[model samples]
Target: MSEHSIEDVTRVVDGVLRSRRSLRAYRPDAVPRAVLEDILDVASSAPSNSNTQPWRVHALAGAPKQALGAALLAAFRENTLPPSPHFPHPLPEEYAQRQRDFGAVYYRTLGIDVADMPARLRQTEKNFGFFGAPVGLIFTIDRRLAPHSWLDLGLLVQNVMIAASARGLGTCPQVSFARFHPVIAQHLAFTEHELTVCGMSLGYPEHDEPVNRMAMPRRGVREFACFDQFE
Candidate 1:
């Protein structure tokens, strides 16, 4: 059914995934509507739990995206909202270490000393700005669904990022937006039945930014995977 050999597909797919990084800065140029749509169309092929397709995406750009970002920034500065818990409390040491490692690498790349709270705060604020990306996407799921459905949503999100990456676009998936769910729900006016999942930034990358070059190390397959039946 396909013209390309299996090796061709494997090479291309591997290249795309390896090259994709969570870009924190982007050029101001706007992404065309059709291109955005096409990327999403490709992402629609991601597998869902029993085809539940529990993902709802809100793609924002231009004035609307800016307006939402402004509202989020204001709320962030005021520090009035309740914290949205992302990680488990008293998170196990191993996973926590990985998170710390990520932060160290990320900040080090930008030449920001980890102890510089002010600088870190400012950089954190940029998340609300979608890291200067032109298109900001908000993903949501129905509150009633179980964790399996959320996993399905993540599959969709991964597909979106990979699809965008294949097209020379950059993306960042930010869970910080989940903390301002009320503001987003009011601003975007989505149904209350839905729960905020996460937000993402998508746009043409600004290649000159040093943060764009930061690459976190990943554990080797032998370190993270388990196999028994294979010989």
Candidate 2:
């Protein structure tokens, strides 16, 4: 039996979802280990097709996180990282446009001009360091799993982000880490059947930072949805 009214639960859940954003900067304070465990426990309940439950998470903190970031950064600097093989090679025009628009707004919010290529590159490089977050997380899946499993994995990832938000933590899911999969594999032991999916940065956001306020606009329901024979 639950004590909360439906309205109360709805308000709290909606607020948690709305408050979540990909934060680019974070405070150095460490999130307690118990809190991280609790977030993951909540996220593990995300639905999966046929109860496959195909999600693997590697949470990094302290020295191990720093070491992995250093290795990846070195690889990035040397241009040794491979292109991400899991994602579609050519994004559709509409999707590309949305990405470009997000980049424009994100950079502008940080006071970075489009002409400043070096600054842009530096900002991109910050992904390797988890944007100064104290916790870094890497996600993986069995290499032989079909695309549907990857779709299922997305549900789990969303759960993780939302659960963290509910607990007053901020998170950024970084696909950029997929480019350095080999570097990560070197640091974290993965069974031969496993494939790196992505990484995430987690911590308390530096709310005072203007860059943390950068939010991309979403398409309206009219733009992205279709109505059936319903009222």
Candidate 3:
């Protein structure tokens, strides 16, 4: 057995966490099956509520992934699906402002005008293609589960991204897919009990793509957290 120094582990772990971000474009290189399996194996270690481990991931590639993307794009273009709200009806100004900022920065990076709805819709349609990534992952949970249990799935989702990032792969966790959940569910033949939690795109990031180079700003820890007692 071997014991490693805490300092050694901290630097490596922090490096991985800090380097990860949502990759909007990816290279066409194929991610080997074994690598995907290993990433999930590491992610499966995420803590579960009383060990309930309630997450299910449908990893897609090749033909199936294409089929799902096609169906989702069709649903998007036809404008036939019932609305799936990804945000609150009336978002607080604080949060809404942040969302607006992100949109401005995102479109600015792509050189798309914020006022061009048609151009933006075309870009938004890329979510169905997994943003050109080699792998498309759909995570689900039993629809009957309570909201608290859904937290466990969120943990698993974060783990998946971190694990993949550590392996030098890029990922994007997308709520956009939720709007097309019915299309995904039908294409994947999910049981009625399975509820879509989120979708993720995974693969080697295309650094040449302008979107991949966009950097998002984040609030400091002090802004989002508080200390009850000082050391």
Candidate 4:
């Protein structure tokens, strides 16, 4: 057996990042339970502060998954959802601009013009249905945990996504689902102590869907990264 070179590892990492996207549509096929467990096992290996692994995940599939998605959509339709104040109110101009750009690109990929508000709204609502993915995962953390733990949980989620990618599986980490946390908690029977952090839709991507062809654009490292010790 030959040892992998640094260049080989770098190429693999680049491919993973470039290929991974927020899969909007998935095939109806089911992901095996054992494969799901292996993905979670890889996620668990993510590093955390003081070795405090604060991530909790609820993976659902088949009937139960469909039930949860339907329940959340119902809550959304009934206007009975609670507020999610996780991020700061009134985002900075730069951050807001980037978000707006992402929305524009996303809608365009679906062939939805900016003037078509109803179409955009309908597309956004598809998120509640997990884009018809066969598996849905809800990530949570204790309310008592600090903000850093949420960051740690993010790392874990990234690990899960990357690991899934290596296996030819696709995933979409969804913050939209967090908006219906109350409904999700009730459906999942989560205790008051646990707060929903994020949700992920996982399965095989629908290769034929035009919407799935949208690859989000990213800024170069120099645009976001900075050097230390400014003069």
Q: Write the per-residue lDDT of candidate 2 for residues 68-140, one digit (tens) a residue.
A: 9999889988996667875566888888888789888988998899789999989999999999999999999
lDDT of 4 by residue, 132-174 (tens): 8888999999989888889999999999999999998999998
- Model number with the top lDDT: 1
Compose the digit string of candidate 3's lDDT tens values, residues 73-109: 9899999887677677798899999999999999999
Against the true structure, what is every candidate's RMSD? Answer: 1.2, 1.3, 1.4, 1.8
Better of 1 and 2 by lDDT: 1
Best by TM-score: 1
- Cα-based lDDT for every prediction: 0.93, 0.90, 0.91, 0.87
TM-score, one value per model: 0.97, 0.96, 0.95, 0.93
After superposition, the stretches of candidate 4 with alpha carbons farther than 4 Å from their true spots are 228-231
- Candidate with better TM-score, 3 vs 4: 3
Task: State each candidate's clash count.
Answer: 0, 0, 0, 0
Stretches of candidate 3 above 4 Å error? 1-3, 228-231
Judge candidate 4 at residue 189 and give its lDDT. 94
Root-mean-square deviation of Cα positions for candidate 4 versus the true structure, in angstroms: 1.8
Q: Looking at candidate 4, what is the lDDT of residue 71?
A: 86
